[model samples]
Target: MMLIEETTVADDALPVEAFKAHLRLGSGFGQDTVQEPVLRSFLRAAMSAIEARTGKVLMQRSFSLSLTFWRDAEAQPLPVAPVTEVTRVALVARDGVQTDVAEATYWLERDSQHPKVRAARACLPQVPTAGAVLIAFDAGYSAAWDGLPSDLQQAVLMLAAHFYEYRDDTGLSAGCMPFGVSSMIERYKILRLGMGAGQ
Candidate 1:
């Protein structure tokens, strides 16, 4: 299965002012405006890192999951969490033709941790050969930054500040997340228990 991001978070949705405030940049000095581009980059990077570590989309956006066959026809689990809506389901043919699935055949199971697509009746439609099925859905906390959890907001601020402070540090390893951010986001991490592992 492949998950494709259709629409990304809007630039305006980012908390730029909040990030600047966290870095203690004063408005009167004009430094904030001078470093706006750097701040924006750091904010984006921090948001991405946090999302990757926690498996939670910080802002609302659209995504498409494509697959050759359903993992489970009755209830296919979506990869991302906090899915707000499933916009459409389509069947792509070998010749590149696409057909939309009927709305009556399926429904979204809205559990914040494990949103899924469940068959409305007994079973779902057969998966076509030589093509793919695409499920389009929206996932995230909310469209506004204020909708983010307080801890996540704090984590973003902390991480962004770290990035800003270490802007020229090439010694840092790839995907080098700070300890404070990790600890702050620990509770949001998804822990999957294997069979009988929960016992």
Candidate 2:
């Protein structure tokens, strides 16, 4: 199984100016813009870190999940949370032929923690032997930073600021997450009950 990011969040979607404000940096003299690239990188890294730790996608983007077979024919849980829509489902043959599944054949089952693609009838379209099924979907809390929950938005900015403050510190340990960031994202983490781990 392979999960591919079909579309990434646009650079403008990131809160560059907001981050500058958070950092209390000066503006209008063109000095703040000099560190824009570095700030952007930190924000991206912080977002990735937060997303990795939590099941949530803070920014809207497209994703494609390709698998040889469905874990369940009637319902297949998506990889991420807050899915806005399921764009397409296709079966690709080993010979590279593509067959698109009609929208009426399936629907999205929305959940905060686990969104799923469910067959409208009894089961999802079958995957050809030696072929794969591709599911394309969009997932995120919102397309803009302001649309996110206040806690998540603050977590991102906090983590990004942590990165910025420690940028030149060679002694920093790897995977160093601040306590505040973790506290903010704690509720967003996906918890397992040790049952039906197969899913």
Candidate 3:
């Protein structure tokens, strides 16, 4: 499942109009004809709306902006991040279980400076899971955990499903995926058959 939401930063809080004008002038978009003020207002409103929905405030200097209009309709453009990075997923066995029926832990690593993780962390306790934990990160990270027992696999799957659903709805991109729960269950089943294969 995926969560969908908007994120924005206030226009009044940044010199967006000036920045836009600078871009137009540099790009030869006719500095005299550029409506910087109107563009600024539109950007401010759009950014504010996104921020209000997703609780993310983007730094103006960190991104470039663009706008387009067609006939009587116009689209509000979003800032694009230049870097592409992988997201890490990890499963930790809760009680040192080595089989498929053990409890586990799930963690997501994203930029430590992201406000979404901070907000999510504050609301973590309200998630209703007793042993669940959330962690924030600044760079690419990965982890390996001991295998979990069968009964716990279902619970972890439920949590992973919820996360997948939420992220799918939200526009943010991350590479994390649920692995341990099902993999361990399959491994345990094979082991019971006296097979020596492991995933």
Candidate 4:
């Protein structure tokens, strides 16, 4: 089973109230089985832990964790693939930036099919990227019209258009999906933030 945990901000960190409006935006997509309230509670606790450890709120971020399980029955080997579970979290900053985080864990069982094992292994690396992209897109678009340079703004628009085109031509509509645009947008926002801070 997939489990999600929420975190609370640290005493020295940004106020939780600051991010409340943006926090709920991405939760709809990351969690599948858990109730919204339960997920929120989990997130609150998780964020608190993170803030305590890191000394900053995980503003505009999303993450996921995955677990795999398998069981054996009988003297004779039963052929069954392991079950994989994934958990994802998205965080948005008060300023509208967002980040995605995800994790996957694998468990091996006796008498498991080789193909199933391989497929599960393959999906491991992809989980984090998928979560990150979703978070970045949301954060990027939400702040796209803000005080960005003309060139960078144009690039963002182009990326947006391309994402739509990709969705139309290929069954892969990155633009239409919540996570699709997030990764690129997140990067852009980071660059802008860094530049502004430097100046």
Best prediction by TM-score: 2
TM-score per candidate, in order? 0.93, 0.94, 0.21, 0.18
lDDT top scorer: 2
lDDT per residue, candidate 3, 1-199, as tens digits? 1122222334454344343443343556567435555555544443333333322332322222211111111111122211122122122234432222111222222322221212222222222122222221222111111122323324233333334345445543453334543343332221112351210
Candidate 1 per-residue C-alpha lDDT over 33-79 given as tens digits, one digit per residue, 9 for 90 to 100: 78777788889899889888877888899999999998777988888
Report, for all candidates in order, the number of backbone clashes: 0, 0, 23, 42
- Mind giving the per-residue lDDT tens digits that candidate 4 earns over 59-105? 32222223322221111111211112223324334444554434333
Per-residue lDDT of candidate 2, residues 53-129 (tens digit): 99788899899999999989999988888899999999999998989999999999998887889999989998999
C-alpha RMSD in Å of predicted model 1 compared with the true structure: 2.2
* Candidate models: Cα lDDT each: 0.86, 0.90, 0.29, 0.30
Error (Å) of candidate 2 at residue 120 is 1.2
Clashing pairs in 2: none
Q: Give the TM-score (vs. native) of candidate 2.
A: 0.94
lDDT for residue 23 in candidate 3, whole number 0-100: 39
Query: Which model is ahead, 1 or 2, in terms of lDDT?
Result: 2
Better of 1 and 4 by lDDT: 1
Q: Which segments of model 1 are wrong by more than 4 Å?
A: 195-199
TM-score of 1: 0.93
Model 4 regions more than 4 Å off: 1-144, 171-199
